[model samples]
Target: MTTYAKIIVNGSPITKSNFKLHNINGRAILPSNSGKYHDRYALYEQEIALIARNQNPDIVLEESLIAILKVYYKSEKRHPDTINITKSIFDGIEKSGLIINDAQITRIIVEEYYDKQNPRFELELFGESEYEINYSINKKSIIDNPKLYFPIKKNILKRDSDKNIDKNINSNKNTVTNKNICAICNNEIKTKDYMTADGGKTLICKKCFNKLF
Candidate 1:
């Protein structure tokens, strides 16, 4: 008997015959060509890689959920928006016998999008207590789903506080350095030099300072 691990994407079961796996340096790698929705599946592969590299077990299942979401999005092409995408991903993972808590999954999605510098999709995972997750293309259906929205007002506040703390720390670091040399320009800092608000500080040589200032 040959033993093979079953791969499930977005609530759909994928078999070894339909997918190809390669081992690179002891890591399991799934080729982008193994699935019809190669683009989305590739994202899944990347997510899995990130989870493994980070050693985050909490998000391992969520990564799988994302894989399924990509597959579903490729097929449905509409409805439920990002929230629904998350819900459907969770549902599919649950049905696949993966053990994961709903709240945990929600937290992961919230952080992933929140931390992304340039997100491809805009999803306000934190909002009203209730909203719809429409799986249909109809705008009316999306407007009607009550459970689509997850209340994340508190999470947003926390993120703000975290940002403020980081800003303060960076500001203090710059103040202590007191080097006004423009990081972009190769200049030296003198005792009487002044640094600007930006990382570049004015390290005006007495001549340049007298000329410019």
Candidate 2:
């Protein structure tokens, strides 16, 4: 089952069914909100700031409940309320460990309003792709012998050999041939029988080849 995390902003909890936590350096932050994830501007800005400050991020997995609050009163128009909410959210993000420099804010507007039943909000922050988490297991305790839990050294070596062979075959296939011409220099190639140095069709002349090499 996918893990979730609880998001807390300005001492208030944000409810969400599936929570994914990201740790920027040592700081922990949330990616998605629970229920109808409406506050896009606030979340995106905060994420950007975090990415700017921290180069390496450590991810945390957990389950969380989020309560989304409306910025404006029910009777009031949404425009003013949205502005206020965005401002407040930005303020909260600034104080929530993410440091924003003098960079200009880039905003993306979502036309459709967020609905709990029919929500249409989908905005992902730009950063490095997520990686899988690997757990270190103790093999000696789990099995009668530690060797039984892991593949034999010979088997591992054989697999590596097979992989290397495949790689060599692929590299040979991709190597440039003598018949191909160089895209940069329109020179006739001397070697047409053998494979070119680049594994592409040989097109570069001796002078061009010397310059490139």
Candidate 3:
């Protein structure tokens, strides 16, 4: 809930699943083919742009950000998938000039619910530091026992894997900088309490590792 910007678009969100492809000069080209989609997308852009312009008129964010979207649907049956409906909303946010590009969004949180009388979605943006702090504070229990949220097999983190883990870490040691920085946060590793993920390709510091959990 630690958001820097928040907006609510009062309409059903559009999905990009209805895109149509065409042939131009024997080359395949895909385009959005639904007029309803365009209308809703334009509505989102206009509302976001108006709010952004009202605040600074020339504001644009290029830093890494987190987007949280809450969608309220009109019915419980045959609703669109959350993933399928994100593109148009993100594109609208991009077109609003509130941010230079949607590519700046490094994380996304989406939730859906039923709201028969008022179908709409709320969008909120958060900075990295704010999101990390808020998430850590609010989700402390989940982090403490990450295995509950992300279960692992009995043999995954056992003492038997120590030798293999050490070998992988040692082999990838040369890939890091002289300071041994964490690949995710770019912070120098000051203690031996660090580990690798993704087949030992990513070096993660203790703080970043805890955040992941």
Off by over 4 Å in 2: 1-80, 102-104, 110-124, 127-213
Residues 1-213 of candidate 1: C-alpha lDDT, one tens digit per residue: 111112322222122222332222333233343222322444443443343334323323322121212222222322234443454334333433333444533323321222123222222222112322334344573455463645545543334422112222356456433233422233554544432321111122333323332
Top-lDDT candidate index? 3
lDDT by residue (tens digit), candidate 2, 40-118:
4346556533542343233322222122333222222222224334333434334333323112123223222433333
Q: List per-candidate RMSD values in Å.
A: 20.1, 21.6, 18.8
**What stretches of model 1 exceed 4 Å from their correct place?**
1-31, 34-39, 52-80, 87-117, 120-213
Quantify all predictions' global Cα lDDT against the true fold: 0.31, 0.31, 0.61
lDDT of candidate 2 at residue 74, scale 0 to 100: 25
> Each candidate's TM vs. the true structure?
0.20, 0.20, 0.50
Instruction: Flag regions of model 3 displaced more than 4 Å.
Output: 1-3, 23-58, 133-213
| Candidates 1 and 3 compared by TM-score, better number | 3
- Per-residue accuracy of model 3 over 102-181 as CA lDDT, tens digit each: 88888887888879899988878777766652344254544453323344458544464232223223455555234555
Worst 10 residues of 2 by lDDT: 119-128
Which TM-score value belongs to model 1?
A: 0.20
Instruction: Output the number of the TM-score-best candidate.
Output: 3
